[model samples]
Target: MFKLLLRRFFSLTLPLALICAAGFGLDWSALALADQAPPGAQIFELHCAGCHIHGGNIVRRNKTLKLKALQRNGMDNLTAISEIVLNGKGNMSAYQDRLTEAEIQSVAAYVLEQAEQGWK
Candidate 1:
């Protein structure tokens, strides 16, 4: 009976400790990488990469980050992008709760900058 209890304790506690450590480690890595780039780029990667890979929207054929497309949609500026990000339009979900105001600003700034650079 003593051996059984010891085995059970180790089996549960060991995995639990490992899982906690991994979660903390991942968070630390995210913070470190976030500092390496312009704040917006990092935030964009975390939130937008799934759909807007390389500034090309997979979900929308016409709504891309290319200069001409953005200009056509009136999304070539920070304010426009911020509004879309905050309120979400069409298929995109709103990030108002998921990201802070500063983060949304950063992403908006980043998108415009990247667009000017032609997404290089």
Candidate 2:
């Protein structure tokens, strides 16, 4: 009886311990939280606001995120903006590794929306 109980305990716990050691046993709450993607404005604030505050570029005056500049630079659409956010352009850093595809798209949409709104 003692040996059977000990064997059952090891059988149940060994795989769990192994899974945790392998980093598969993530916290359920953390996983749930990670499953939720942040909104576009939040993402933009966290990543792009420093350089492109209020849709204005601090580095290059001509390459601002405003409607006029975006239209002139051929970045007036979501695809163009998303591509730039993923691959980056001059004076802008790429966020392909730091953000997911959906996040990039969200921020791109946010930029276009804000541009249309005149950043108000």
Q: Give the winner by TM-score.
A: 1
TM-score of each: 0.71, 0.68
Determine the backbone clash count of candidate 1: 0
Candidate 1 lDDT over 1-120, as tens digits, reads: 999999999999999998998977757776677689887998999999899988899999799987789999999999999999999999989999999999999999999998899999
Clashing pairs in 2: none
Overall lDDT per candidate, in order of appearance = 0.91, 0.93
Q: Write the per-residue lDDT of candidate 2 for residues 6-110, one digit (tens) a residue.
A: 999999999989788569755777757655646898899889999999999998889999999999999999999999999998889999999999999999999
Instruction: Name the TM-score of candidate 1.
Output: 0.71
Global local distance difference test of model 2: 0.93
User: Which window of 10 residues has the lowest lDDT sum in candidate 1?
Assistant: 25-34
After superposition on all C-alphas, the RMSD of every candidate to the true structure, in Å, is 6.2, 10.3
